[model samples]
Target chain A: MTVLDQGLTPPAPDLIPDPAVLDLSAARRDVDATLAGFLDAKEQSAPGPELPPLIALLRRFLDGGKRLRPVLCVCGWHAAGGDGDPAAVTDAAAGLELFQAFALIHDDVMDASDTRRGQPSAHRALATAYTANGGQSDRAEEHGLGAAVLLGDLALVWSDELLHRAGLNVGRLEQVLPLLDEMRSEVVYGQYLDLQTTGRLSDDVDTALRVARYKTAKYTVERPLHIGAALAGASPGILAACSEFALPLGEAFQLRDDLLGVFGDPRQTGKPVLDDLRSGKATVLMALAVQRASRGELRKLRAVFGSPDVDEQDATAVRKILDRTGARQTVDEMIRTRREQAMAALDHVPFPAAAVTALRTIAESATARQA
Target chain B: MTVLDQGLTPPAPDLIPDPAVLDLSAARRDVDATLAGFLDAKEQSAPGPELPPLIALLRRFLDGGKRLRPVLCVCGWHAAGGDGDPAAVTDAAAGLELFQAFALIHDDVMDASDTRRGQPSAHRALATAYTANGGQSDRAEEHGLGAAVLLGDLALVWSDELLHRAGLNVGRLEQVLPLLDEMRSEVVYGQYLDLQTTGRLSDDVDTALRVARYKTAKYTVERPLHIGAALAGASPGILAACSEFALPLGEAFQLRDDLLGVFGDPRQTGKPVLDDLRSGKATVLMALAVQRASRGELRKLRAVFGSPDVDEQDATAVRKILDRTGARQTVDEMIRTRREQAMAALDHVPFPAAAVTALRTIAESATARQA
Candidate 1:
């Protein structure tokens, strides 16, 4: 059973409190140093005249983003009764982070998102660069979009290469390759379903949640943890349990993100309030609101839901409909319910007490964060 | 050094004849059978209940493209002293063709081309379906583009899965993996340079040709051969010699294509006249035209080139300028010269006379093909 504490709890078989945490600053410094060395190696391979632009792309897109995926992957491996060199885990985890870069770049372009991680998105950044360098204004946007698309392709190809070269054994290769392939395929399929769901919101809340679970939850949490645990040769039962733990946590994370998209501080989100309302994204909360709204509320939503020229007043009206229908409270309750369900999954996992404790802390922190 | 007559060509050691001409019916039968098996497997993996749309995409985009890469790849293996099972080579070559599928889908989106292989391109087809299905016009177009981009990404990821499961040995894996990675990296770099070249006309013919050689020739030809030969554990020197032989031939192939893009019969090329001119592609021919034109001719070019709104009269004016400025004949001469150079390289390769003779014939046939 998981024991949540600031310090390591329920120590596993032969487990001790990570002494590294005693000196938290030094531990953070070490991780940063390790990451920097790896990035430098990546940069060196892409150096000189012909490849510098692509290399610059890697650096630009990769920098300033929290390496959350990699850290989670490495920690998952460590928590799975695996130990050798932390560096090896870091290298393997870097592949996951690179895959993240690939996904985010393509996702932004597909979504026509102008910014990501509080900065100009890759396509917009490239378009700005093209314009600043006196490229054609009309075509610069298209060129930038095309280049970003190609860059994402390059990253996806190279992520495979990186994972292949991660010094893993044949056994690990045999186990992980199919999982990774499945993850990649399902994520793309999930994206298609998401884009497909936009204009057709005929599906109920259950169906919308299923789409959200596959499109965001499984990808955002379960896959990375599985990759790490698989590298450590975790048993299938354990992996399944880990996924069970991850899924609800992931769902809650996205639910929180949906709330932030609609109601969070604009300065913190780096996006305007009700951006999802403007985009008419078919969120689980929105679908619930549609199902519960009165005749008048339904009329208001129908008027403003997908109009491209939605004004601030339209957004406010939509928010009023959400509140009046109690959709906001219902979603908040759902998030808490999922978060508890995720913790219950953790309780079922027979991991080491320290790892279980750390994981519980992570789950709470990840889902409860404001931005 | 090379033989033209069928009887005069010595029997190759392990070389296969050109599938296009020799045993044409049998080769067509094999391709048809293999493609059927592939599509059947594809359908089984992506179930209709969940992924019918994705299956339809593969059916439409990959159904009838010319299997030139597969044929050339299998031929390259045989020409390089490989005596592996044709089925294995076919499987491997089919992976390359799938890769080509991925590249074409994305390239069509990037170039915003309306047609591919004489049919509506994937995005266009999807957009047409969307509109026909009574979807919103703007949303349908964006969704089509987004879906196509992700579909390409899916194909690319699947290509790697195909390679990993092909049941090759460690030595073959070592050679093939590096070549595949380098091929991917170089293709992206070449694409970047090609797009960059559109902004300025270079005075140096060699630089322009180098761009063409890398962007089209190497990817379209040499790398496929390299992949096959690497699979066969061909000696380093032999592989190097094969590249030496293939590079110029590949360049000639693209040069011939560039020629066809401009002035060839629509029936032969399966594309309209001035396709390249309308696209404002800075091809080797265009670069030459820029360098060769007089002041008035240059003014005419500057007015007409790269103007997306150019009318039919402007297109005809550009074509007339290409003829009057001798750009057409210059490109023609370049193709012939490159074909000769390629043949010259084959003569210097230290392969068996029988193999060399077969290689020479294949090279000539590739350059002389109508489509």
Candidate 2:
């Protein structure tokens, strides 16, 4: 049976609610408070003083995130007709943020990225901290990488702790756990797929989109909603509805990210514009461009794509080729189509009106964000 | 309350068994079968063809392990008078092995080590595979590292999946999970401490032992036993007994490993003898030697320690000083003492006679094995 068929019975009419509204800003605050309190307890109860710095590093890294997953999770709960103080949902939401911290920290190490969220990435920050603390200068970089890895590991495990303590009753926990596991495996597998395709200029748009689906669509969008709805004992139909809305919007979100990676202003994006070009990310935009490039344009793309030291001039030249080939415009059109599809799906979903409105806002913002 | 105090009532006499006999080798075989089956299912169900190689890579990695943790987990189960068919316990045992695989893969990457279990390390193996597949040779190394990181992440999450599917009743799972979480956090913290002290050698014996306690004693021994016993609804007293026996044995085991790392034959140890010396492992033995070394010995030690290119001659000289300073003999004495303590603890523990005998055997083999 499909996930949508898991709950065969329809919800009683008495259980259905009129459109309900939630104060999202207040929900975010509760999530942040949960996270802060959890970290504080961890620091206070740490086995040794040496652990505090790592915990602090994670806390700082967490501060820069937009809390999108947490927000979506709370929205999912509301969509499923959940009624409560939202304390448990907030705790789970915070856990998602910690998991994201784990992912980004390790991603930076794997990519050897120097910055994140307009600040030094975890490893870079750690390296600077090591030097400031009188460590040998030569060993700072390796030490930072190792420390950040351990920190990431801690975050991953602690995320589990947070979820366990989220106070989900046994039945709810059993329902949530498998989806959480699936989300984790999908994202990791997606990353592996991305790793395999990276640095190789390919026109395999299907593979690129598959990466987007696993890495972004399911992991970033579908899973959080599913998890939150599960916490509310959402019926299979309600979960299916959430997935229907999430997938296309998630894909559009990632596509917009790809465009911003290469074309957006560095100041606005908080990352260098040439990073995607230099890394030769196996993005759908790049694949479309490759599929349609002329011989001279392909040569120019090949010359600078995946180069370690690609320059602004090289990136500008590649952009010209992308625009000339209509790949850029095609991606924009794809985003619009996907966004519309997501909106249409939302219209048919059995969510409260306020929930639908919040999701719509999220979709629009996610696809149109500068950063 | 102390972990030992969790169960206030004594285990009834009827619950105790006479020295129970178990076929440990058979248990190991069963655990291996479980792991193999699980991986087979994962490979068959993977979302894409690209994921098979990673699953296969993990299977091969699993092949090289001694299955020490799995054996300990099963033994803990038996020690706690766990009855009936061992299928569920074996699944949990196999899950522990997968967790070890996760730990080692990341550890190898962090150490930048070239080999494991006499094979190229995961990163190196992936690099070789990448080059063989006609990828750019230079990019192969970075790609391999990235892929290994993802592979490690997958193993970690999949380990959670395995444990979840081990079919413990809800109450039993509740008892086991917190221990599992504690174990994960302790090891990460241990690794973090190790990282902080790795390259900068000092006579900080307490710091070195703390690393051993967290990284090896708790993670490798105590927690596995605790988890297994918890699965059987073991009394707090029994868990305390397990810790009493495990901690010293675990520390001794790590001490033996430190000696092996510097002096064991590569063929027997399945790893190069020069790694610890080259890496400047701030092991207890090294710390003791540093504390007691004379001026000339200190200079010689400084020259060879932490040097990536130290040769046999250099290792030989370092070994001579280790012997001359009595650090080698002192470590041996420390192992002997700790082993005795573990044995003594086993004697007073409330375990079936067979369990106690098996614990003794493990202690002897672990502390004295050539490899």
Candidate 3:
């Protein structure tokens, strides 16, 4: 029941109007156009036919996913009063997206995820294609897996390639490099903690929370935003304030996601019910539930928590235990509190009113949405 | 028998030195000292005790491995008539070694190598430690594998970190960056070809050789030398000549390695008899053997090749087939011819007499050694 094990698969009953529909600067719109063109250009530069399958895998993996991180980066740059050309901004944003692509590909393989963003995961997709094609059936699975793994490595290498070629200012790049390094290092360490934390429910709550912060919260929001802000030459004081706002916001975001993973409606979440429960995620909410459960509840939870064969009846029993023990309410309250804390942090930072308002709206919607 | 597959392992007895008593230049010696200091300095900077285990793994994995790449870099700088402070050269050399570290770590994981430099591979070593330390037996293997994977990523990131902090001339770094990218991209693509070539022993010989050249020949020796030469601002013509010299020598080095993997003395190679046969490596010799084998010989090879459970009898049969088909002698002749071609290329380059002599000596020793 560690924070890392907390619910993340939230369900959205219906799609909401774009929270980012607030009037964007002309520069921002131009940046978006530029990004679209850049991605198109990358596709046109595919090495050869031998590489088409890999490129397709990337294209499919990237489809229909929210470009939230890149959007945040653009917003952060704007909020910091940076005035780069649209091309520059777009290049930076695309670099961020490529980095995200790399991270997601590796993370999927690491998690053994069968799907991502409502489609077959990259490895599975490649495997499917391999079999459908003329490849040998006996070795096709291994070949596809190998290809997917290498594709992830290629993406990571290409991320740096994109950044190196982006023609950004040296002063700015030097400043941003360490921040990016820290982001990478912390996230990896956070993942290490996460995989190591299973069944260690009685560990310190603060330790679990810190792990969650590094693994999900910072990587998801803070670092991406900081990258943009750093490029803008934001002072340390200002960057610190943004991190303060981002930390709580990111934590709330993950907490909400965790809640959705288990308790959210399937239609809203684009997922089946109790995915995290079935996966045996060691989340904060689960920890809280385990901590406060009655002896009988604890015994039942221990019996079925990680069982691959847990039936619908067992899932219902676990859900009942979650509700009866008041952990659900506790987690819900925590999410609300964190969201409020994020807003409070923002109050101390000076930002353009429109961007600030947009960020606030995003915070509220992110935490409160059904998904 | 892809070119990339040729250098999949260490060079044969005739390509490498004793793996001991190799002469070290002042620059290389200085770089080694700096690396020791840097490793110590880095230990104090990590977030927790987690680094110790990782560092230990790296130390074990790196120990006894020849710093040939780094040495090549330093020698190249010298050959190009560059005269810089010893400390700076060492820092730059460290950069090269760090990159090598990244390469080796990732390569081991990709190859599923059980041992490196006669010790348990990093992943297996970590997994062994995890089990011995009372970690969950079920996940001990996974933990080790994941840790090693992440460790490789860390080495890559930190390799850049080292270069960034090396305080080398910005102009020099710019000159080197594109070359570095090419080196990395070519190596990865070569790996792709090598992996894709498995069981393709009867495929085109030229394609296999091409893969081998890119994967092993270029990356192992050519690029490291180029990095040094580029930093020294060598003329394009001079660099071109260096490449001509390096390419074939590198190829010969790998060809020798393939021979050792299959037929060299087991004690010296530190591997079992027919190791490559069991592992199913698609080497130049294997491809050649397949091409020249009679129908009966081909059947025997098909039965033994890539079989994890290949027995001594199967190994003897396969060896007999390779010998009978004259493939072993052909490969040996190929290695000799490539070595001669490498020396001939050096004749066209107008380097200083001392440099020419030193490089020639290295090439001669590198290509003519046994174990």
Candidate 4:
């Protein structure tokens, strides 16, 4: 049998701890450890040394993410009254994180963005390595793009490997698979909608929110919770509660992201403020501002929006229009409303006290944080 | 419950006749019908109308290719003495076809290929649709590339879905998963190796052969057989027999492909004859030509190779040099040797008489056909 064909053993029990005692920070640590061990094993079992660089690149790319999905996944397990044996849930959480890495890598390529998390994006990093290794400079960019595509594909497949090896029983795996499929298709459709709307200014707030709900609300929040809850064999009521609490909080999180993309410090967000403005993302904030703008304001917005040469000065002008239209304040108000709604949904949730407190904390931080 | 969560029913019994009675053309028809039904169901059950275009695009793209992998998978099943229900094997075969679709779509994107199977490549087709649908002309190309990336990702994931729903028992599914993983990794690595070598003239025939073995031989031939054999719980000896026949035949198939890329009629091959030469693909044929060329011939080859502007006159000159150097003849000899080896290996195979006859026919057609 191939090395990969060898049966997987469960992670050490001590690494997982009791779900009742698992806080977000502890969960993050366990998830990180699980990811590290998995990647290490992959490296050791790799067919050749040629793959280490790719594994290293993935590991580095993975290092800087917030691990938000993993934390929520573990929280969902607790929310389902699961009190022990967090190993399987943690494994699934690691799988989600790898899937996120895959998404981010491909997204960066699609956007042609140069930086992610304050580092050269996957394609850019791979290009740098190509040149450093004596590959012709003229071919480096194309090679890097190709390599990044392969890397993303690998991560996507390996994520499946991780999920399958999460040690779930057949029934639990069956329950989780459909949710995973839904999550995957939702995010892809969301990206397609986003791609279609990008570079074209529009005042359709409903379309913007629909994209946000599909791309962020369901993908980033509800699905992970549902997947974890499914692992615990939670009732449909618990899964429905997850949707209620997750959807609004997830929307608020993205709304906050929209504001941060335009106004947050580069040091804080690890991305340039002008990218969203230059791309002319069909964000709710943009739609709101466009809908309410005066003729002159609309002309100014159109002049800077979707321009590849849009600069900090152009961004400053755009911000003035946003503020003058009260779009900034409106987005803030929307975030507040959604955050409160998310918390209010939590009040009726049947989760234990610790889980409820954790979810509240996540909602507050998710909506209110600058980055 | 969600529509996707519903357990998959088996294909109609009539579609999957007794293994001994299976006809290759009938198997192809059944596999195609299964694919059509699966995709139709997916389209109807999609979360929204927005996804129909994507689903339809995939269906059209899948329509044009020869279902080689799927056919080989069934052949392997028969070779493994698999009997009665062919439902699971056919489902897995369909999954292989989707995986191939994913590979080709992404490969076309990486190569910036304008056409595939005599039709516009995925990105090109998408770009045309984008413009036809009134998307901004300037952004259409980028949008197409992004959409194609998403499309490939969707195909990859959906391939996994098809495999999961292939109705394998848990034990059989476990057996198949690692082979699937290895197949995925091998093909990606093969593509990476090809990417690294393309546009750089090299005289390393071994490296070229390595690329062929990994990229086409193993991926296009060996793994599908192994996956099908694994599905039937084939013994090691039977699996080894599959490899003994598949590897050499697969190599000969690629060797024949190299010759066809240069010399075969475009009407027959459905690909431009100049693509490989213009791209300076480091094929075994090219490597042999380079290795044996005189200094003037080498200079002439270098001048036209990898030149996008090289025309029919330059191609004729290159062909003359290739003929003088006997590279074309060498490749023919190589194909003949490998084909004979494949046939010889099959003589010792443990498969039943019908499977043996079918495999011999496949080996001949795969290497000898113009396409």
Across residues A1-371, which tens digit of lDDT does each residue of candidate 4 receive?
00100111222356345554446777788989999999999899875556789999999999977788877888888899876778888988899999888888888889888877768989999999989978779878988988899899989888877777663442476667778877887888888888888877889999899988887889888998988888888899999999999999988888888998898887766567788888888899999999999999899888888989999898998999999999999999999999999999999999988788778877877886765
Compared with the true structure, the alpha-carbon lDDT of candidate 4 equals 0.82
lDDT (tens digit, per residue) of candidate 4 on B191-304: 877877788888989888988888888988899898888888888899899999999988888888888878878776767778888887888999999999999999999998
TM-score of each: 0.87, 0.92, 0.87, 0.90
Ranking by DockQ: 2, 4, 1, 3
Interface RMSD of each: 1.7, 1.1, 2.3, 1.5
> Which consecutive 10 residues in model 4 chain A have the weakest lDDT in total?
A1-10
| Cα-based lDDT at residue A347, candidate 2 | 83
Tens-digit lDDT string for candidate 1 (B1-371): 00000011222334445532233224334655665677667678762244666667776666655565665565566656666355655666767767777887888888887878768878888788777767679787787888889888877877766665542532356567777777777677667666666655445567667666666667767887777677766688877887887788877777667666666676866676655655566777777788888888788788767766666687777677778878878877877887888788777876656556656766776677555
lDDT of 3 at B326: 88
Better of 2 and 3 by DockQ: 2
Q: DockQ of every model listed?
A: 0.52, 0.67, 0.37, 0.54
Evaluate fnat for each of the predicted models and list the values in order: 0.54, 0.79, 0.15, 0.54
- Across B1-371, the per-residue lDDT of candidate 2 in tens digits comes to 00100101222244345336556667778999999999999899999999998898999999977777887888798789887878778888898989989988899888887777767889999999999988999888888888898899999999988777663542476777788889999989888888888777789899989988998889888988888788878999999999999999988888888888887787766566788888888899899999999998898888888888999999999889889999999999999999999999987898888777767777877887776
Q: Write the per-residue lDDT of candidate 1 for residues A241-334, one digit (tens) a residue.
A: 7788888887887777777767677775556675576567778878988898888888878777666677888888877777888888888898
Worst 10 residues of 3 chain A by lDDT: A1-10
